[model samples]
Target chain A: MASKPPVTPAFSLAIDAMGGDAAPEVVLDGLELAAERHPEGRFLLLGDEARVGAALARRKRAARICSVRHAPDTIPGDMKPTAALRIRGSSMRLAIDAVAAGEAAGVVSAGNTGALMALAKIVLKTLPELDRPALAAIGPSARGDVVMLDLGANVQCDARNLVEFAVMGDAFARAVLGLTTPSIGLLNVGSEELKGDDRVRAAAETLRDSHLGANFRGFIEGHDITAGTVDVVVTDGFTGNVALKTGEGALKLMRDLLRQVFTSSVPARLGYLLARPALDRLREWMDPRRYNGAILIGLRGVVVKSHGGTDALGFAHAVDVAMDMVTHGFNESIRDGMAKLATQSRALPV
Target chain B: MASKPPVTPAFSLAIDAMGGDAAPEVVLDGLELAAERHPEGRFLLLGDEARVGAALARRKRAARICSVRHAPDTIPGDMKPTAALRIRGSSMRLAIDAVAAGEAAGVVSAGNTGALMALAKIVLKTLPELDRPALAAIGPSARGDVVMLDLGANVQCDARNLVEFAVMGDAFARAVLGLTTPSIGLLNVGSEELKGDDRVRAAAETLRDSHLGANFRGFIEGHDITAGTVDVVVTDGFTGNVALKTGEGALKLMRDLLRQVFTSSVPARLGYLLARPALDRLREWMDPRRYNGAILIGLRGVVVKSHGGTDALGFAHAVDVAMDMVTHGFNESIRDGMAKLATQSRALPV
Candidate 1:
């Protein structure tokens, strides 16, 4: 059973200041940046008061509307979600608690993804219209930035789940990416209509006939992701996770190979110095920091997970994503989209 | 019904001369390279006799060991596999025909992948011990070269199919990659035993207790593919295909970005000139031609597919791969492994 979540005035956000690899500093610095953009927003900072309070006081803007909550414990990055869930004193859990308790509209964390997801689900519960919450993130493509969903949420999803993902992703793009109408594509082995399994085929059929049919671009292959064949790429958790990791791995490999090439000889080392500026520009364009936020959509409260290893800028980008989801009524949009989808499913044997 | 392919003297290979984007030129030039390596090798060239014969006559070494089959019709690269199967006069079909007629031990083609797979399956059939034939390829990783299988072969694989893939991948690693005892990992969303679909979990269970259990590394996540945590990464075709394409796409994206940076300014251009030699070495190490061969594993006959977009050097690598498989008695090894797997399954309730 799935239903849309109630619309909430998500003006305040809870922060897990002890989350990320950089921890309290990244959170404090990120909040300062976020505060500059959302002057009216309030933040409930969860972590050690002594640590975050000293840092928060230094950031004028972040300190103005932020309140530091005493959370003595910090969840280890490698800690299992089940173990983390039992530790209520952890900053991650405390931050999520703020959202559940209506102190904040959403919670942002740069901690263990598994623990975050598990804790968020148990506390916030899923939206009325979702069987499970999905993780959605933005990635660069040849054309532009593209939105991909179900990064590692549900390992197994039926056709219905895919259709639901398309709805959530469309709303997400509209909100964060600011696309008026984003083209949707179902990731598969081939772009041909006859290709893929029954679940993928069925999902394609539903999307094609649904209200979002105008933006549905049918099947797309792996290369199509970077090719930017569509604005939103949707697939089950397993394939999506593998694809994401594989893409990351390839990029790292090339980066390493490039590094090796640049340091191989004295001539090459000099060449690297000359090429530093242009390469820096290229690096900025492809920076993982710019796309650090991964939203857990379809949850009762907004949840954005930042990369655990990211610095202040990356954590700030994640904050921006969460704020956008809250301010733009991202959940409400999903509700409306899902309502239409439900009507369509009822009208046809989808 | 799965049975081992009959062992034959595989000293000769059939060549689809007019297959690649460069057609007879890449084929003939590639044969010249293969001939240099295998002096006793025989090649039956299938293409327009005048074109292939004229080119063959120019290459002294290739001319000595090659026989032109006069296959005038060249299959279009974009032609459907079903359509290709009906075209008996086509060069791609003729090459397979020579292998079927026992004139050649195996067939190599840089033709339409779908057409080749379809035609090969229809003519040669699956091995006695397998439910389906899989496509396997080698790719670079952090540690070294790694083998991944079922790359768009079976979209929906069961537990049995996954287990079978492990056996085939193990044999492939030993035969083509020349690994003594390759560590195999089942591609999953997470490495935890509790994660993934039932089929994946079941496959992991069987592999954990099989004869290859010592080398079986349980489950591996997507990043592990590039991290080289295992020697062979095995998964269903759909996921494998997507992961491979994603990795390729990422690499291409980085390459394009690097090119843009290199040409951005006068200084960058000068730097590129200085770095050209070292960059060239890096390019050679990561060349597509070096890893051009994608074998159609579990087939009754040795069939290797080359990238249609590749050049002569790449095509030669495919020939080299086919020759290696033949020399190593790959299919026989798979049979022996499967036989042990069968006995183990019989002994236990796998």
Candidate 2:
């Protein structure tokens, strides 16, 4: 007799259907494409059931796939993260509750970043001892994507925050990149131990004293973000936000400049003709979607934030990312690791 | 009879011969080109007599066109601004002192920024009623170059620092861009009045209450830096430096990405070929050298900071910028206007 095939447990994503500037349209499109790619991946769209159903019906996808869980209100995009949490009917809250109730393996949103973080903290909660949650984004580097964290998730931070981010960022690197002991760094204005503000100086001292799973590679600078300087670069949210947006604005400006340069004169245009092969190799490497989704780590279950300006293709990419986190058991691994570390010391913030 | 052409006072520029990474060579090159550009322009190269003489002979220029003023010690680039000020023999001191003594109309440097500011403060001093000096740079924008400050001159700032930057930056915009009244906007994380930290909020209130020459346009964001959303964007030096560099780095990356995109496929390369004309216009507009010089505003005399990594061409542009400021009496106009304001309010920082 043939051996019985083992059953693979099904995992579902609680997608905040009302979130995102494009709303149900982009979300529905992303969901359908993701379902096509991962036949086993399922979604529970959380929003007004009637509206979500109607939107899905228009795409003719309602009958084939997807289910709706009604959420009455939503956190406004402009509302403060702290204020948004008090609103109980907010869709972010409902989505987090779904994960906590075991209805979904993870949650995803491109909505109010602060609200998602707050709701994640309230419902999903951090590991029993974890003090804060960090938003980690994977960036396109020379080697591949590098996971960078606290990309504007926290306003103020201490030495402990840096150490925690390092720990969390390491788990992210390992799960996403399959690197056992990824090299980690504390992002600073300079690579020297004596560089940057006092907070960073304190963090550097703390990182040196701790024994993180990843290798601590001193400090990293602005250019290092793109040069593939480390597997993980940790910083407080303020600087991270500045770095991320700076990169975005720069990429946009450069794209415009190149088009102008290539088409400006006949000889330069001809020179571009000769340089065409090299340029193509670079585009595939810098595609924004390839680095779109950012995981809100330290939550009880997986949660991802897609860029607000992403197109259908980008949204699809983020969905595939959400599915990968669930399948790889990234959260469980992080929890177990932290639990182990917690036993070793009681000084951790969590 | 010929009305004697108003006896054009001998135009003098005190070159900080020991300022940049490449120092005397680039300074001499800049002075030579500047002298060539304006037959009336005379250079007072401040450095050791031997080095200046060697550099001048190498250029094969007539020594009569330039004069040398001896100063022994050089300010090391990495020294603290305050400490550098206390050291008496520093070349920066002697060079700035020349400007104060009416031997030179302006001073230019590519060396120790902090030392330059400190010595410039001690020698040239701030305009009457002015508190701290600001390093102002012209950012490339869609409308034209926008005057921004403090471009990394001071890190910690209060509302008064921002107000002074606005006042100085407005004067610059008028002097260079020929605007009767430039629009001034505080660079905040957002446009809303209450969007920024305590300092920003207080500054917004102060700006709304104060009277500056430029038309105050409220707030602008990082994206606005490139979009030319406002004529003058005021922030503390720290954020300004990060924003400016971020924009620069992003432009380079995008240029790289565009080259890759156009060359990757045959059709895209053809598109690039078709789009060649537009690209060149963009590159010429965004060239760093075109906007290379930064004015150290609020000083009693004109002081321009040329890019540390400047080449011969860039150095020439800095010289041109200094020439315009001197010809237009840029510093005096600001000193006069600010002095007028000083009589009315004794509480203002500057």
Candidate 3:
């Protein structure tokens, strides 16, 4: 509700082309697809120019709206965040720097998550009222799409940090999911108010008493994540990270089991052939590529991290998330919401 | 490895009949099924005589082995542990007391989990070396089955607590799953040693140096839960609870989506008919009844908690878990393992 209209004109996004498993190839392919989807959008591609140029030349749509900016190095997948901070010319750093320098409205990368988070936090910095940024990602639920935050950024979070996450997650859902007023729930072991640890209980108290209380749905269990019990699910990094990965693992297990079942007997294989179209639709609906982007919320500029192992389609989905944030003036809304929360907290009794 | 042959022969198990959603009927049905499977076993059925007698009248096998103990009250599912503790004659308390008095080798209850854990801890007490008890449960995995601990027992755990969990989990895997030596892993966000909090890192260090180090597999991610990367998963109650429920949520989502897909078209329905046998096998393999019990580990007596919402088959599975623990001398193995760990820890440098 606090969101304001976009003050700035349409802006270009920067891409870290030399990141992810497929590097320049997948990045270029994703860019081409994104370009066709958003014809008015422009991209500043950061990587080795020779390789990026060659990849771009093959894609007419991407070549029309994308410009290459060469970078000499890339942040390795296993590099420590502290070690990654010193690498100035790395593609991840350069793409982030583009946002800082006003050349790009946001940055998208299928790269080393820790390194990317470290670089983005340093380059773009947190919003004025927020202490730290959170990683928010969309997950497919039975009812619809659900947004969850603090995915692995701050492993140990306090009450205040959780409150901040709830605020950010609410804004994220509205911006990315196109919701007018997203309902929010704090992820807990049980739905009862007295279920979790001190930090979670305190956070729930604050949310219940805050300006966003109307949209707050109190405590929700882990099953609520996929059940779509609420539009936004807020949690500490440790629990969020584990819950997200656990869901992914379960999905993979079921998929593998389904494949084994279908291939086990001749009749089953024949049935698979007849059901291929419907099954394909189901697979597409549940595809990880559709929800590849993990957004770093509560930051001054938009930053979307794609899964490092994702293909072109997944990478393009990450780009789409960044585009949504930029187009919706997501940062401005977060800043306004944070300012209101600060004032409201100060006015309340200790 | 420290497990010994059962010294106590042919002991009866106490069942809390006045619990769960289906109450006396499901409990009676489950007892009948369990009685048929283990005809040598006897049961001390705890509930109101009128209700228990009426339910048992229709059953032949269970009526032969079960003797009813009149329990005037039942712990309501919504009652807190502290409140439930005051009600002495409740069915849950009486069942646990049966184990403490040595009338029963173990207790199985589809009742209030918090109350069961509380009463079991207060009545039966923890093993000498264990500070607190943990809730361990079997979950279906890709390879076979996996054991995860502290499902909802200890909300916060220290390094020593986690190490104790690893020890208890190892013993649990051995006794319940019939494994000689089960591989153990600490559940974390990443498999790397440096990825977790200080407590987790400290636990890993301790497990690696302890006598149980032979079975220690270092750190494992949340995905490993369903992947069956380790025989036992060690985690604090908070993360464990969230991960377990999230996995369940994902599975339910996939099942619902599949059902929707198959029912959308006439050809899909026909394909479903052709694939019915294979799909039935898959469903059977993933059935919740097969993995119904959550065991309270590190206690002096074996205590199994069935899902309150589960039907007769699920309750029977819970009884089976209790039988396995009782027959294998689970408490004795845990005691022996803990004694070894205590000796090993003292010899090392602080």
Candidate 4:
């Protein structure tokens, strides 16, 4: 194994080079791309040193900013998170260790989400105000980019957890999305005051009375997500995960149906040729690659999880997400928000 | 008020004419369309006598097989279900009363959902096995029409309730969707066995061992709903409602985005004209009107609730749904399935 990582640049991020479906090469390519955009973003590439170093040698830009670190093993996607904890030499574990050792500002991986979360919690711990960290991601909405959280992190959540997610999502929107005072909405079955269980209602009441109440939109239904009724849509992980996947499925269905229609006849094919440019515009606007990262919020350090199926550009976006959080001191913002709310009154509803 | 209803035909349905946004007119129009489809179908319209009678006079097809019943009151869309229950003479209540009194084989309404369910429970009653009725609806999937249940009917479902919903959904798919032995799945965050709550796991276990085991597909994710991974998707009403609405919202967004693309440029508009036929075909295939009814299963009679914003065609489809269930003895089938399950050890997990 190579020697341990040396002192790192301020915004350096640890890359789990052997994590994704197309590992090492895609990770290096993504880092090169990220290096172009974020000149100040340095990387500690953690993987099988021989393969990762060879790949890093080919990508001049990435090599210039990245230091190769030897990780003896790779975490398999199907392995249980608890079991993976014992595999300390794995690329994912090494990246997380870098963050814990203060060699990296944050860590990014497209590895097993469960393993990443479990490892990050143990190594980095959580922000003091958080009971559990939330899985937050940015997706396209009619108005603009909207942030959603708890996308399958904590299966069951109480009022305090929900309120915490709202706070984190709110802070994320302002930090990454550059919103002045981003509004937030709690996802419910219906917007009616009487709808949803006691947990949601209680969370709403707490948010409503707090200082964030000025930007709090009461309750939004699932449809409000794409309708862009609010900036940050917060919910328990169970529903949030289902809702996110459901949205993806619907979009996929539409895309398939549209493709079938376009190829149905010669005239339709011709129509597609003519409409290609505008359709391409639509495709670009809704590209999933542009929103590749799903971050674990309420963590002491930025922790971004890229989708396993993503390509170089998508992985680059995940790196961008981590760097954005690191540079903006996002955890500080969340802490500040919680501290202010606590001073005003107890953050939890009585 | 008029006299009591006369003896009705075998497949007679009571119409809540004052229930929908379009009122007695759209209800009568839908009946006229439904009459053309089912010459054997008869209706007893409940609303203000003069208004309903006047509307009936204009629709020759509907009038020939229908009779008017006077119900002077109307239930508001936002009225609480409990409050609506006290208004006995409201058209929704009258239609439910007609079902309870054996004046009609089923009932169709586009009224307040909460009120309809509450009133129907009081009047028509739930079948013996059900703790609460589940809402079932058909929607377009890649393979074909897929039946999903518990769509905002019973928010919190126990293991027993989920098992009941699976049985009811099985009966519904066979009788209404016309599948010989429809496959079923329990919706969860992930398809893994350990993905969902205890209730879903228990229900899966029960289904796996029961007679329905052959057709059960274990756990499925939310994306499976539109992917047509199974013929029936079973979930608690809260998640189902959110998933259903999320799908709707995604489709709406795609529709809007397509429209914008089509109108964005001259070449695009010309391309749209050329592609109009195929696009229309796609629209027809995925038409919401084609899947119009959400039925309250586990009830004594077939009770269909139409979307309030639907047109005459959509309303007619809702009637068609009700009549299909009535003719197929869907409720009887549900009872049979439950009875069979009861005979094979207790349905709930030990």
Could you say which candidate leads in DockQ? Answer: 1
Task: Please write out the lDDT profile of model 4 over residues A1-350, one tens digit for every residue.
Answer: 01133344343789999998999888888999999998877888899999999999999998889998899999999899989999999999999888877778889999998899999989888877668899999988888889998899888888988988988998899889989899999988889888998999999998998889999999999999999999999999988998999899999999999999999999999999889999999999999999999899887678999988899999999998888888787888898888877876645863
| TM-score for chain A as predicted in candidate 4 | 0.95
Ranking of candidates on DockQ, top first = 1, 3, 4, 2
Weakest 10 consecutive residues of candidate 2 chain A by summed lDDT: A1-10
lDDT (Cα, tens digit) per residue for candidate 2, span A138-237: 8776456788888767745776788778878888888777788888887764575655667667666656555663388888766666667788889876
- Top candidate by TM-score: 4
TM-score of each: 0.95, 0.82, 0.95, 0.96
Candidate 4 TM-score over all chains jointly: 0.96
Q: Candidate 2: where are CA atoms >4 Å away?
A: A1-11, A50-65, A72-92, A112-118, A121-131, A260-284, A329-350, B1-11, B21-23, B57-65, B72-93, B100-102, B112-131, B256-281, B327-350
lDDT of each: 0.88, 0.73, 0.88, 0.88
RMSD of each: 2.5, 6.2, 3.0, 3.5
Instruction: Summarize candidate 1's per-residue lDDT along A164-192 as a digit string, tens digits.
Output: 99999999999998999999999999999
DockQ of 1: 0.82
Q: Which residue segments of model 1 deviate by more than 4 Å?
A: A1-11, A345-350, B1-11, B345-350
Candidate 1 positional error at B297, Å: 0.6
- lDDT over C-alpha atoms for residue A69 of model 1: 90
Error of 2 at A237 (Å): 2.8
Writing each residue's lDDT as its tens digit, candidate 3 over B1-350 gives 11224345335699999989889899999999999888989899899989998999899999988989899999999999999999999999998888877778889999998899889999988877787799889998988899999888988888888988988998889888999989999988788879978888888888999888898999998899999999999999999999999999999999998998888788888888888899999999999999998899887678999999998899999999998888887878878887888777443222
